[model samples]
Target: MEFATFILAAQRGYHQSSESVIRNSIEQAVASEQAGFNTAWFAEHHFNNYSLIPSPLMMVAHCAGLTSTIRLGTAVCVLPLY
Candidate 1:
């Protein structure tokens, strides 16, 4: 079985900046791969409150160099929404 984690840059507290959340999420994905996870999935969202990732492809591209074996994916995305 392949283990995976949903990577969402969530702003749970007032001090958590969007940039930091996104950076941390990327770091977590790399860590997840190192920890033996099979995949790292990103959340796609247009709104600001829920998630910081608007494009999973963008995240995948950014993380491609940072990760070696872990596969990257998106949870949900409407093609025409953008």
Candidate 2:
């Protein structure tokens, strides 16, 4: 069985910065790779408090350099919303 983690890249507290959330998400992806996850997924959202990740491709690019073999993916992207 293969396991994958979904990163929502959400700011958990009022004091959390968008940068911090994104950094944490990247760190989590590295950890997931170390933990033997098959893939990591990032969710995209816009003009909303739901998530801070506006582009999954951007996240994947960032994570690619940090992970060796773990696959990176996007949960879903609504192009119409973009």
Candidate 3:
């Protein structure tokens, strides 16, 4: 049986991302992997303040290096559609 979990990756923006925020997000991903999560779901958004993630795919790639067990994916894929 496959259990499920989620880690919300904010749409990185002008101010949403600082060194600390990035580091913390990475840490959270690592922790989610260690905790037996099935996937780390990220979302893509355009220029806006509601969310902070523009390149959700890039986020998946980046987090892929930090964890080895869990999978990474995009949830609400808005960037490519619009």
Candidate 4:
């Protein structure tokens, strides 16, 4: 069996700052790797507070240093928007 984690990087409301949301997402990825997850996936979003991640590839680059074994990927990328 394989396990993976999807990081939504969602902000419920104004109570959560953008920095905190992104930081939390990074933390989640690190923790997921430590927990033996096979992969850590990031979601892409733009121009909205619902999801703060603009580029999953950038997020993957940031997390690559934090995790050594776990694979990293984007759940989905809206190419038209890029």
> Model 1: per-residue lDDT, tens digit, 1-82?
8899998878788688888988998999999999999998898887665788888888988998899899988877668976
Q: What is the lDDT, from 0 to 100, of the residue 30 in candidate 3?
A: 78
Stretches off by above 4 angstroms in model 2 are none
TM-score, candidate 2, is 0.91
Locate the minimum summed-lDDT window of 10 residues in model 1. Answer: 45-54
> Candidate 2, residues 7-74: lDDT per residue as tens digits?
99987786988888889999999999999999999999888657999888888998999999899998
**Candidate lDDT (C-alpha), each:** 0.86, 0.90, 0.69, 0.93
CA deviation > 4 Å runs, candidate 3: 1-3, 10-19, 79-82
User: Is 1 or 2 the stronger prediction by lDDT?
Assistant: 2
- Between candidates 2 and 4, the one scoring higher on lDDT is 4
Collision pairs in model 4: none
Q: How many backbone clashes can be found in candidate 2?
A: 0
Whole-model lDDT, candidate 3?
0.69
Q: Which ten residues in a row have the lowest lDDT in candidate 2?
A: 73-82
Instruction: State how far residue 8 of model 4 sits from its true place (Å).
Output: 0.8
Using all chains and alpha carbons, the TM-scores for the candidates as numbered come to 0.90, 0.91, 0.69, 0.94
- Candidate 4 regions exceeding 4 Å error are none
* Candidates arranged by lDDT, highest first: 4, 2, 1, 3
Better of 3 and 4 by lDDT: 4
Give, for candidate 3, the lowest lDDT window spanning 10 residues.
Answer: 3-12
